[model samples]
Target: MLRLRRPNASLVLRALLVVVLAATSAAANEAEKAPPDLARGARLYSDNCGRCHNARGPAEYSDAHWPLIVTHMRVIAGLPGEQARTIEAFLRASNNPPPPPRRLGRLAAVVPAAGLSGSELIERYGCRGCHVIGDAGGSIGPSLRGLFERRQADWIRVQIQTPREHNAKTLMPLYGLSDAETSAILEALRAAR
Candidate 1:
């Protein structure tokens, strides 16, 4: 009688290892080929980081330091490897955003923040870049439809000046705006529809 021979354990084990390695390499290659989506990363960062404390500013850490920070947070926050890498990319990208129009010259960095109306202040600072102040703006942040009604004046003021004080971590850039600028921004937000 002819008998069927069983496959050798060593050969099976080697083949399994090869398959596993090939799969792993393919996954790594795919990840490398795909570009990190900054918008998705930003959303992920907002969702994950906000769950704990607050969002952190991209400029808070240097490019060299961002990887380490993201890795640590990834572990603590239990974020996936791909997501953590995306966040790192977003942070690094944000840390070095494109340059604005040089036509504004030296004074562009620090608008006088005086004699400007609330709406003017908002426009000057590009508040609409991240928040939907009224009918139009980016969707990155919450809509500033009813600011004063929702939050105390002091709280709003603090948020404008230093967001970290409230949430401990946030990607909101500190504009170092003066009292007048902050007040103007607060008023504009209050008047937002």
Candidate 2:
């Protein structure tokens, strides 16, 4: 009579296999966990605005200009407040990122706000489709040369926040921005010249 015998497998080998499998599963579980707000913002930015908007530093534009540009992006990009906030955080983190602290100078670094420059915002939002900035840009909109010198900051802020409020025939659309964005855009415009 021939008896069937199971192939010999070491207990240690089986234990190792089980441990490896458990570790892999744990790693996967961690990845599946919810992303932080900044991560969400970065994902949202890549999906919605990264196509046109390039990266920049906080000093690229004044702290005053970040919000206005974001306002326009919020509308044109169709992002929700949570997503917008996340993107804003991501922008601030990337652009106006913190400077390494000085242990001796005791001088605080002036950092730009957490968002894109007005120029970047304009480019990303397709303002270039109509308006022109510096020597290059689009032709569909008005030329934005020395706009800060031509217009008062408050007036410029108002016009940007609500274009229709100033000119009924103006084709520029209202972006409904926060004060911070308006300030940033205006500051950027001031520096553009």
Candidate 3:
């Protein structure tokens, strides 16, 4: 005869936590290995899914649900793995848009990014949405890695000021960065390598 005892709840919870953390770490590691290009992802998502999925907002789906949905859609639409991954990244980012402006009587106030650190400003402006900084970001634009090494400060400044000057069809938004802000962002881009 043999007797079996079930694992205690605490033991089970600890096991579950370990499993969850391991999965999260693995996913993060995989993401860093070859980050998806968000700009391209958005375009692909629109192109492949716009007609059928237009009625549903991405926010309506759970984060965990998207990969599965994208997988199924990929099979149906014959999307390549790279394209599917890009679309997944874009969908994940779009799941939560930035919060609306704070209201003050008749005025709407924005939390200014003027004084944030270079990295913070980069995040605030969503530069990674189009250009890969280090191992992350979209592939729509040139990688910011070795940015300073390749482009002169003046040239980068011009690009920052008027992106269209560099590329006639550039999709980058003009941030109208102040001298200080511009310097900070440039420094950040330089350090991204």
Candidate 4:
């Protein structure tokens, strides 16, 4: 009978350690790779979440909380795994986006306009799709220029919140504008030349 020498215990242990180290190094490298596509995530978020709720900026939530929140929302919104992951990646990336580029002759950071700006509110509700505001806006409805001169502030507010109340034949849709949004729109219209 031929006798076989037993394997060396130290050699076996060293081999195991090398394998472990290699695995760890590979995992670290994977972790350091570029993050997922944030633009895709933003689109996913807007298409799904923005339908019912305001599409809040990603910086609203912390990195740790985003995964959990998005995971929960995924089920409620019936989102697929890939879409949820993409949105989570976008939220993580946007949580701390780079600062805006510096502009020449720009005034030192003035206080931002309170609440959503008028232009933002208009765009958000697709007001330009039906009404002409300035040089370039929609013409389906009456021009928004000199609206304040024609309509009272209260009338504008009422029309925005309840369009049909003012005109039975009005094609304008009610946006259920918040008080802040209403105020901002009014301010913007008033400031328009």
Candidate 5:
């Protein structure tokens, strides 16, 4: 009688890893092939939409609302179907909300209350419509890429609290954020570096 040997655990694990890596690489290649051109979308938006009303940034609206708004705008503005779709893609990509913070469960007791990050606060307040944060945000306001390098914590806090105090002709509105919100945003900005 002939006996069969079991597969080695290490061999099985290596096979699985190879399969996973292959799948991941294939999916990444597919994605890269059809990547959306946000610059084209921005230009289209400026040329077409900016003709009438102020061209609102993508972050101004939620993902769900963008399709409807884009459809409406497409009809009103007489935009081509492909251009409309491209614009919609850009808006959806830009306004993509961050995932909700994970709950710590039992660890919550031991860990300090870590509030929302700077990016989160910025999104919550729709500041991306005016300011550029990283590669995703708009350019109506100043780019906050190196905000900490230019301004101090107190200055930032004061500017958020009272925009006019910092700049005489600032278009930024007073958000009237609470002290906790202010501190959380400030901490996030500091931690970003």
Candidate 6:
């Protein structure tokens, strides 16, 4: 027969309370710690997205409005799901309007030589860095504003095929282009005038 001295209810209660308090405090501390992947998230937003929209700034709309804007741009801009997400992250970081898609179209070849559009050539080799045409580009190279009027298609073709051969000191990089790309750029240049 066990004679239990009056239960030490106070001691048992105190021990339970200590355990509960310790667990709660630990959880709170963890919640207060820094968030993971903050730097990675920022880099991902910039490399794939900053060109099209501002990151982490004032947006014209509320958070609820962003999804609709993203949807429209993804389809119209031909962005893949991952790219769209990158753009979304950038826009969410700073509320900014997404850039519009560049306008491009193939020009009909008037002369016998087959070709790609001037716009296509520009986009393919990124010619905007060295040239400017009206409001379109920069000054890395000579302004080709009226290249069509100033140059012949055959001359342009030769230049595309081997720029250094024509001018050793030319700042233009040798694009190591195929005959087809040369023809296309020439055709587009001819059409530009």
lDDT of 5 at 20: 95
Q: How many backbone overlaps does candidate 5 show?
A: 0
| Model 6 pairs whose backbones collide | 56-93, 56-94, 57-94, 59-95, 116-184, 130-141
> What's the CA error at residue 176 for candidate 2, in Å?
1.3
What is candidate 2's lDDT per residue for 55-131, written digit by digit as tens? 33334544467667777888886777556665665555434324532332222122235657766665544444445
Leading candidate by lDDT: 1
lDDT of 4 at 144: 85
Query: Model 3: per-residue lDDT, tens digit, 1-193?
Result: 8989988999999999999999978876786687556556655665677656552445667667988999998899888866788778767665643343234332112233445777887776567756778788754456788887888999998887666688865555555555566667777887778
- Global lDDT scores for all candidate models: 0.71, 0.58, 0.69, 0.67, 0.68, 0.54
User: Native-vs-model 4 lDDT?
Assistant: 0.67
**Candidate 5 at 19: error in angstroms?**
52
Q: How do the residues 75-127 of candidate 5 rate in per-residue lDDT, one tens digit apiece?
A: 99899866776677667765643443355465442323665665577666655
From the highest TM-score down, the ranking of the candidates is 1, 5, 3, 4, 2, 6
Clashing pairs in 4: none
- TM-score per model over all chains: 0.49, 0.40, 0.43, 0.41, 0.44, 0.38
Q: Which stretches of candidate 1 lie over 4 Å from their true place?
A: 1-18, 97-142, 146-170, 173-193
lDDT for 81 in candidate 1 is 81
Question: Model 4: residues >4 Å from true position, as ranges?
Answer: 1-115
How many times do residue backbones clash in model 6?
6
Q: Which ten residues in a row have the lowest lDDT in candidate 3?
A: 101-110
Task: For candidate 1, give the lDDT of residue 55.
Answer: 70
Q: Whole-model lDDT, candidate 2?
A: 0.58
Q: How far is candidate 1 from the true structure (C-alpha RMSD, Å)?
A: 9.2
